[model samples]
Target chain A: MPAPKKFSRDQLASAALELADEKGLDALSMRALAARLGTGPMTLYNYVDGRDELESLVIEAVVRHAAYPPRPAADWREEVRTLAESYWTTIRRHPQVVPLIVARRTTDEPTLEFGERMLEALARSGRSGRELLVAFRLVVGFIIGFAQGEAGAQAFSPAGGTADEVIQRGRTLPAERYPRVVEIATASARGDRAEEFRAGLDLLVAGLSAGARPASA
Target chain B: MPAPKKFSRDQLASAALELADEKGLDALSMRALAARLGTGPMTLYNYVDGRDELESLVIEAVVRHAAYPPRPAADWREEVRTLAESYWTTIRRHPQVVPLIVARRTTDEPTLEFGERMLEALARSGRSGRELLVAFRLVVGFIIGFAQGEAGAQAFSPAGGTADEVIQRGRTLPAERYPRVVEIATASARGDRAEEFRAGLDLLVAGLSAGARPASA
Candidate 1:
């Protein structure tokens, strides 16, 4: 075999991410990543301490790409919208990364920085610390949850069915049997995923904003 | 061998639900379900159509248990909260069923009925059909998504490292490296899941209620 190649932590993480993207996260292993980097497994360890560290790095890299624009000093509404969209885009791009994103609890630098910026923006809107924290969790949790559902739809697309096909199936159901589902599914079929995300995000932000408003002086 | 007994579809679905409770949804299969009911796989066909049909039945059964109290004639807020909590309790009882719940389109009869009641409540509150439909979806989607996260915590309870263990690790992170995460994680450690769910649900319901109010007479 040719002399083993040198791999940096970044290189190992990037390779691991690519593997996860291609074959899903469960398929990723230290040996597979090392081989992808053209290094021995032991040599790969010189960079990442273990699977947890490798995972942490991959998540950090993913979040780095999903980072929100610098927090606006005013207009928390726009900031929240931008931040949510950034996260949705990232999850959509790396659909497989989402389960990993949710499963791990990270103390990574970039994710923490992102959290701080979001908290600061919410604080600037004049909410109490507890409210700001709860709002922050709601926004992030909603985006993550919505993205997971969207990803599930993408992953579980039936062999012969599109969203339209499924909606059409609902429409043909006996009216007496499913009047409301048929009605809602018909309307929801025409509902674009992007539009749905925006609508939900707006609803959430509006609630938080209203809650933050000061009582009569 | 004892003569194979005839099995009804309800028996098969009941057995499958039991299997789900015992080993999770992933462990369920036609053979295991048939074995549990003391019948051959072929006999199962007499009651349910296939795996997909059986899954539909299991979901319907679980959802039936989630039914809300009949909608009071015009109180939309109470109606919505009751509906949300009912589904929440269903998910809590059958955590393994969530992926199936989220993936399948609403096709069961009881699920359809539940949708009708929710729509009627929203319609009475004066929102357009489109707004009511969107709000219904947002609520269901949020609950399903939140349950997935909560269920994951239960399913993957940190072996040797509970949330408490993880929080302790958070404390060790340099304040400069992870100020907000450390702060947030510290606070979250003291948080209760039921309280968190109630807060989120209330926020969502309050927001939708505000949006649905008629603008001027």
Candidate 2:
């Protein structure tokens, strides 16, 4: 008879990530992962120590997919934008993983590597060590924050509410009470979400560029 | 015998907020709130429609606490700082409410009023209507995002883990591999948490101020 298939830690983590993406994070369990892998739950423990270790492995795998190209020998702006877009794409592709990425405190090797590359890129652009670190965090925090809001919107979406439904609900409020919000909401409703993200990113990059100064030039 | 205490919608919501503050949002329930008020769970329905309504009401109450002062007839920078600080203080006081605030599609009246004042302040500072709205949201989004990170850290701080613990955890990686992260993290640990928040806020404000242009000549 043919030998039975073997499950490696990498394969197990990949399968777990797929399960999280297809179903939600809450639905993920060792039993289910084992079932998917054609192995008993106890056998799966041979690959991963426990759920926490499995989750950490999954996070590391997911983050590795999000890595940027080594910073271009160019302006910090391009480097920051590349890093932001890479990270954003990763979160967008695996919406379920985003929350886990945000919550996990481990300075795991992959994440530290990502941080080091970003810091070097910022430093090469003439930013001080402190400004470089802070700006790197600003971009990371902004993307994660924005992704959280976007993911929540995609998940809930008012249970079938349309853009008009949202705007109509806002308009029900007294115009005198929320004139500006009403006005902005009306305008924003007509606006594209991608455009808004880009605009905010532009402002952030511009603001950071304007603020950047050499610590000891 | 003395009359039983009367319960109002505001009172119920206030009690819920208090419960959330003491325990957490997850622990809040109709039964517990009713018990806190010395009334039956059915009694709460008279004030709030359901769990959803109670949550909405609690958000409104917390937001009311986050209200800013009337738009000061002063420079736009001071006005924006005041608004931002009001927001920061409000979210800090009720960190649990932030996710709800971010998720809700329709903001309460007071929040809208606060937005109008902010828009006016930005307009006075010379931002176009779109710029004003985007910039305001960027600031609000960043503050909410920062607060979430801080709250998450507080919630999951390694038991018996000091700043040194965080540093020691990172030290497992070879210095040659993650020198910059190790350096920045080591330096970051030297500052107090409060100082870190202030420094981040300063970076954001400085970035925004660099982008500001007066609306009126």
Q: What are the per-residue Cα lDDT tens digits for candidate 2 across A27-66? A: 6799998899888999887777788777777777788787
Q: Tens digit of lDDT per residue, candidate 2, span B192-213?
A: 5455555555666666676767
Provide TM-scores for the models. 0.73, 0.75
* RMSD, every candidate, angstroms: 5.4, 5.1
Global lDDT of each candidate: 0.67, 0.66
Query: What DockQ do the predictions score, one after another?
Result: 0.29, 0.32
Candidate 1 second chain TM:
0.80
Q: Can you tell me which runs of candidate 2 are displaced by over 4 Å?
A: A1-62, A95-110, A125-133, A154-174, A215-217, B1-6, B29-58, B95-106, B128-130, B154-174, B192-198, B209-217
Instruction: Chain A TM-score per model, please list them.
Output: 0.79, 0.77
The candidate 1 chain A region of ten consecutive residues with least summed lDDT is: A153-162
Considering every candidate listed, which one attains the maximal DockQ?
2
lDDT of 1 by residue, B112-213 (tens): 677777776666667654565667667766676666545542222123144456656655667776565556556656777677777777777677766767
Tens digits of lDDT, candidate 1, A1-217 = 9666565677777888899989877688888887887767887677767777787778777887876665463577787788778778876787677656654445466666666777766665675434555666677667766665455422222232434565666677777865665676677667787887888778887777667766411
Residue A76 displacement (Å), model 1: 2.2
DockQ, computed on Cα atoms, for candidate 1: 0.29
